[model samples]
Target: MNNAPVRTVSDAKRDFYSHHTRPINSIYRRVVDELMVEMHLLSVNVDFAYDPIYALGIVTTFDRFMVGYEPEADKASIFNALCRSIHSTPEHYRGDAEAIKAAVSGMSLDDLKGQFEHLGEGGEGLRGTLAAIAHREKFKYSRPFGIGLYTLVEAVTPPEALKEKEAVETLFKDLASRLNISPDKLQKDVELYRSNMEKFAQAQEVMKDMLAADRKKREERKKAAEAVAEGITEPVAAAPEAGESADSPD
Candidate 1:
């Protein structure tokens, strides 16, 4: 999806409405598309700094499932208000009232994270997986401040925070492979995250560490290559005279 920056969240919402919101098609499209739209709205409206880029991508993806009126208001403070709206809004007014209600009203970063952690403590199921993906995808990761200080910097963000945000792209694919989730029916992935977060946390961390290690190695290699190039171009120090002891150990 062409989710490039569009000035403000207002523009982003407009871009989504103008483009997405279409008639439901196949079962797969229905399930995946609906789930994506719900997640996008909840993420954007959550009480935190959401990832605008991915939000745009998701809006384009699911085509504005149910959110079309909260862009003007303060996103960070509207979580409760948005939830109330979802619950109070008529069923006919939304594509899926229950889905909107659950995603919006029942979700929070703390709750989601706690649920995820609990799942791992016991035993993980589909809920665990979903919670993990939702949390990671919605929560933004901070990037480094470009100070050449790896230890002190966070490094390039949400995308780099983990291997990638699979929620929008391949997460459904992965889920489809494992479960019998109907492509046509709406999923409770957000609910799962609201209930558990451990499995997903573990999964995300594993991927994050693996990816981080890979990035570190790549940086090292790049630096090594640059050093080699510099050595070749730099003039060598003048040789000492024959009488001069280059190595005066004494």
Candidate 2:
């Protein structure tokens, strides 16, 4: 048996370095997962890929705005950016414009999940990759796109185009710059909106059941009232003219 020196240097070196070392995405995923669980517990439907990303933006905005809420070193900031990128909406990129618009306009968690699944399997799509790149760059800053709850939608949108997001960021930055207010302040306003939505959804369900019950009770009461009215109108059959004439004769 011939033995080779273990220390011999060879051009073929085994580099154990993997692209994923607690990967940037893995960290973002953790943040998303935690946020989604909280949202679900709150009775909010958070099934969209974009929903979690939107949540990350809001949570990150809060973290940065609050003076002493840092989780781990600068890792919060890293994830903040990464999460935004993960959910950024494609504006007017190379993909099907109509489809992207449809997705953004009415996208739920399920739609986003489907897209994520598709992307995972079909990595060859150039537009998707480009959108992803755009998403990351756009998210690097704290400004999320759109107004109100829609802002959350824009935050998680798969980047297809940059026009709308750029426009929104420009406007948001300008407004913030003028007011000298941190974006976190907006969280309160958005939270109110979310609360309203929750209330409205609950109210809708309550009203549906309530109305049905109310109608049933009304019908039952109406039938009872009608029966009473009929009895009153029947005139008791004149008590059968009971032998009155014979009693008078006696």
Candidate 3:
């Protein structure tokens, strides 16, 4: 019987490995190595962070500023940001894997930064790479929690308006401009911190109002019970008190 050559197991394996797996894995490893080098350089030069987290050590310091280090919190943050960056690397390359691998091979951390120098103008590794850079540059790895901005807000905010985020963010943007950091550098950090701070402040206001309402309700209940025990049949809102503070809370 005449027949065409059958595609055997070996043929399938060769096809899969050559066309798909080998090239991809080779490129992937090269990109990862380059990323590691870039991360290392930035850690040392910009962040002053010494030990790479992926590298084994007794401990590693991740604080951008020597003064801002916290043993309990910032250490964990260092580990988290490192791991997050690694997980995000593939996404940074995305569909243009071959092109990105080539581009990244010769690029360093500073080169990566240059790619995204202008706002809304960025290349492959914009968010992932810049986020790592921002974490390091912001005096520690935690972006979006601006202690510097918070202090400034506290200074300018009225005692009654501490929870207001919009005013504080407006003030922060103005102050940040004075620092000369670009909007690209500040966007993720400021926006994330702004949202968290706003929600926190709003939640606090809600709590304050709830507590005040509970206290008022309890006091009224006590007064009503007392009046019922006595012979007084007066309604609770019998008449408005003269010159009562209209500014008083509900």
Candidate 4:
């Protein structure tokens, strides 16, 4: 069969003027369209499958869409809202609602750390990722700053910190246990530092480009305004020497 029709949430309402004669088709369309729209609204560039339950299909679609769409920065607040909404749903819709959650639960500490470290350079990619995560659409890593800094420090820390020295050994042991990885392994994996460093470089390059572009625009505008004020058709020539007269004809 051809694809289902796509409709926004606004179009899916039951009203006096309209009734859902083809509830299945209408529901399918509404769900699919909402998912698609939510992706854009949430800044999720990743493509996802569109599957709707046979019953309470509209609600199912929205609940699932909201899972990954929850803003990363405000996860605690939005999650509270999500829990409340999920609890309020009818029992029949609960199962389908829970299914949407399953999709996001796959995000783990490691994955989050990787992405956070990758995007924390505050460059174009990181900025874009943050924008999406802020909207609750993309997967934003939670511990980028912490992980990145830890990796950097561990890379260069003195041997005393790593050896069994009483004062520093305690800190090393704690870090190892908390990270759930061995201290030696963490120190050896210097690539993580390189990766974050590269991200920082890329961000710097993008910023340079942006600044250059802005400068070019400002220069152009200044020239244009000068040209208008001077009643010149093109850019003005260099000014004559202080003592030399323009009318003297060099």
The numbered model that scores best in lDDT is 3
For every model shown, what is its TM-score relative to the native structure?
A: 0.23, 0.25, 0.24, 0.25
Residue by residue across 30-77, what tens digits does model 4's lDDT show? 433443344322222233222211122334334432332212343233
* Residue runs of model 2 more than 4 Å from their true location after superposition: 1-182, 225-250
lDDT of 2 by residue, 1-250 (tens): 6364322111111110121124333323444344333323322222222323334344433343332222345444443433333332223111232334344455653453344333333343323632442344223222221222234344445445323645544444443333233445444444444454456557656655766797799999888788878884453433335757534533
Candidate with more favorable, higher TM-score: 3 or 4: 4
On the 0 to 100 scale, the lDDT of residue 172 in model 4 is: 36
Superposed by TM-score, candidate 3 places the C-alpha of residue 162 at a distance from the truth, in angstroms, of 4.3
Q: Answer with 3 or 4, whichever has the higher lDDT.
A: 3
Worst lDDT run of 10 residues, candidate 4, spans 48-57
lDDT of 1 by residue, 154-229 (tens): 1222335433445422433433223233322212432233233345445555655766787799999888789878
For lDDT, candidate 1 versus 2, the one ahead is 2
- lDDT (0 to 1) per candidate: 0.35, 0.38, 0.40, 0.39
Off by over 4 Å in 4: 1-142, 145-174, 178-193, 234-250
